[model samples]
Target: MAGLTLSQASRALGKSKSTLNRAIKTGRLSATRNEDGTFSINPAELYRAFPEPSRNTLPERPKEPDRTTVPDDLGSRISLLQQLLEREREAVADLKEDRDRWRQQATSLLANQEAAPAAPPLVKRHRWWPF
Candidate 1:
């Protein structure tokens, strides 16, 4: 039969006084309008209405994560990769020059072999007439 004051409701229910006042103001909980314009709540009714106060709590703030990236490190890594690509390109060009030199010499030798004369063709001639 005890009518708890606003602060008492906050302590007993483990809620903020402002939160309880809001609930009462928002028509969620029944309260007694006092003679001096104050308010009171039935403790039993509150316990029955909210058996578990934990259920009414707002969600906790999430902990900040430790994940972060450095933009300067990424830029330096890209510069290193580009330098390696340019060196590989120079090596490929030098190998291509060596291959072209070998191909030209082979083409010259084949041309000389074909330019030498071939053996003359053999021919046979015979004639028979019954006129």
Candidate 2:
């Protein structure tokens, strides 16, 4: 029977190669091994194992309004951009605060370690002679 190689089947089914391998390993799908040690799977079997989503099953997305329908005022555009910039600046401040906190914690930990007494090296007793 006509069939597709593993790569071809993966593309057709929108699945990863590992997923197909797992399906074959679990006996949910069957594939033939080529002489060169590559797997070839029947397209029908791939579809059976991983059915494509039906067109009718997918929810329809709302259409976007036409660009010409929207107002193109310069002040409105500037306000929107300013709002985005403010949000990004706030995000940067938050990140900087977190970094400073972590830095303080790490330095405090290091200070505490340095203040503590050092542990003595272990001394090993040598045997008088080998048995």
Provide backbone clash counts, one per model.
0, 0
Model 2 lDDT, residue 88, Cα: 100
Rate residue 91 of model 1 by lDDT.
Answer: 100
lDDT of 1 by residue, 3-97 (tens): 99988878987888888888888888889989988787998777766666666554443444884444555558789999999999999999999
Q: What's the lDDT for all of these models?
A: 0.80, 0.83
By TM-score, how accurate is candidate 1? Answer: 0.38
Which is the leading candidate under lDDT?
2
lDDT of candidate 1?
0.80
